[model samples]
Target chain A: MTGDTELRDRQAMMKAALQAYVDRANAGDADGLVALFAPDAVIEDPIGSPLKTGADIPAWFADTVAFGTRITPVAPLRGSHANEALLVFDVEFTPPGGEPMRIRSADACTFNDAGLITRLRAFWGPGDIEPA
Target chain B: MTGDTELRDRQAMMKAALQAYVDRANAGDADGLVALFAPDAVIEDPIGSPLKTGADIPAWFADTVAFGTRITPVAPLRGSHANEALLVFDVEFTPPGGEPMRIRSADACTFNDAGLITRLRAFWGPGDIEPA
Candidate 1:
């Protein structure tokens, strides 16, 4: 395969991996969500402190699920390079006693040669979310 | 040039252009700094509203100069794509009657085929700068 072809393939794999994680998060499947990350993956949540390693992803997902948050991946994942991809999506969170609030978020993911996500950096505007 | 070589050359040009702007800004050379942007360039400042043309950049720079801000571009400009670059740097501002405060900023710039910056978006932590 040509370099361009390889880069495209890598980008596709990265997108699929990110989609899988989002799907699991929306479904409240903590195990499936955690499985998407590499063993040494790092997650920097827009709120709270950063989580290093895949082991911490479950707790992070649990917190979101507990808040009844559902994430929808938006179209056209913008990639900066072959091994790096940026995914933008909208997420809706429903508090236990309040209405649902929608927030737009963009995540930057890095993949290793094996196409496993090694790092996930999430970006979101603080004003995008409102108290319910 | 090979694809890799071409990409490197483009990155170098971008770095030089950004450095020129920073140097001009530090020297309060408004005209020289504004020349780096395309006529239809857009600038999204970290605070307040966004500017949507090269003509607006002069006003933005003047505001910074009035604030007595000096910007330093850090090394290793990270490029996501061949035509796009992300620059992370630090800026220090001194108020008229107060001490100096430093803020770290990251800018994402897009270049047109002519190598002129068509868009410049600045990003910085809200807490990075302290009231002086």
Candidate 2:
């Protein structure tokens, strides 16, 4: 097969996986969210924070869901290459005691050959979110 | 041309433009940065802030450079589609009365058929930057 065709196939698979991820998050299913990543995937919810890997990723997702966080894509999900993608979206959250908030952010993700996310780097900060 | 080939060519052009933007910014040439934008382009340096258009874009670029800001790409620049790309980089700032700092952020830029930026949306927040 041609390289372009292969890349196209990979893009399709990743897009499907991302859609499923959004579905799970919106459903508040932490376990479903965790199932999307490879067992050893590393995730940095905010690019500057400490990395979460292995089982910690699930815990982090659980914490996010527990905080009433919901993610919705704000733009078309974009593929950077065959195994990498860009997800630009809005994240809504209601903190424990703070006002509800909405943030516009993007995440750059790298996937493994098996279509599992190997790394997820979220690009957002406190200033990115506004009171909703 | 095939869709894939056309996309690849457009991607190349956009990448070159982005590189030039970073180079001009690092050199403190705000005019050069403005040259990259369409005459009536709109730019939102941070997703939630006011939009900068036409002559305002140059003013914004001037203000940023006047603050001793320098940009350097920290990751491989990614193309989202034929005319849109993602630039993840760091912006260094030294304020008039503040210490030097560094910000990690991303910009989603849309290009016109003529290869100029028609809209540039920067994804960053007050929290994305850190003390250098």
Query: Of the candidates shown, which would achieve the greatest TM-score relative to the real structure?
Result: 2
Interface RMSD of 1: 17.7
Off by over 4 Å in 2: A1-31, A34-132
For model 2, what is the alpha-carbon lDDT of residue B44?
A: 72
Cα lDDT tens digits for candidate 2, A51-125: 888778878888878888888886556553336666777889888888888876667777888888999877554
Q: Write the per-residue lDDT of candidate 1 for residues B3-101, one digit (tens) a residue.
A: 656765776777778777788778877778778888888886552234556556777767677777787765344443246655556788876667888
Residues A1-132 of candidate 1: C-alpha lDDT, one tens digit per residue: 226567567757776887787777888887787777778888865522345555567777777788887877653444433366655667888866778887655566778878788887665433335553
Q: Would candidate 1 be rated incorrect, acceptable, medium or high by CAPRI criteria?
A: incorrect
TM-score of chain A of 2: 0.92
TM-score of each: 0.49, 0.53
Q: Check candidate 1 and list the clashing pairs.
A: A80-B80
What tens digits encode model 2's per-residue C-alpha lDDT throughout B43-94? 8766546788877988888987998888877655655433666677778988
DockQ of each: 0.03, 0.03
Local error of candidate 2 at B39, Å? 1.0
How far residue B109's Cα lies from its native spot in candidate 1, in Å, is 7.5
